[model samples]
Target: MNSSRGVLELPPVVGRFVDGVGTFLADDVDEGRPIRCRFLWSAITPTSCRWEQAFSTYGGRGWETNWVMEFTRTGRDCTNNG
Candidate 1:
């Protein structure tokens, strides 16, 4: 599996709160293939956010939704760093 981490920067849309996307790659060790995973997310509040992720094999099939996650920001520093 790929162990490296990557960052994606997306320009803010006119009315959106999301700043970017995050991507992670992993190998399907059992199938001896590589898989691509992506996160599409946005901050909903100073203390919370929502996101969805998808996965697919390279050049194989279309992406499938793996999960949707929503969580509260744990700390007080929920400032925009971008």
Candidate 2:
């Protein structure tokens, strides 16, 4: 994943992308109930990527979830190859 400074480790295959992306989710179930979550990426490289995904469901559901994922290169190589 990308660091706080936005420096990506960038593996040999995917050394073309930068990290430092994040997502957020929030909701309210009842009159006084609120749910919220924040996610961050831990490592990122040109050939691979990793990040944390989290969510919180409050009030009615009272649910919380967290996850991580790794991605491999899936795109066809172009002439540029850079």
Model number with the top TM-score: 1
> Per-prediction TM-score, please?
0.43, 0.38
List where candidate 2 sits over 4 angstroms from the true fold: 1-32, 56-65, 75-82
User: Whole-model Cα lDDT per candidate?
Assistant: 0.56, 0.49
Cα lDDT tens digits for candidate 1, 1-82? 2335555533222223335444443334225556555556665677777787666775436788879999896775547753
Tens-digit lDDT track of model 2 for 1-82: 3567788542222112234554433342323455454345545668777765444554324434468778777676767785
Clash-forming residue pairs, model 1? none
Output the worst ten-in-a-row residue range by lDDT, candidate 2.
9-18
Report how far residue 4 has shifted in candidate 1, in Å: 21
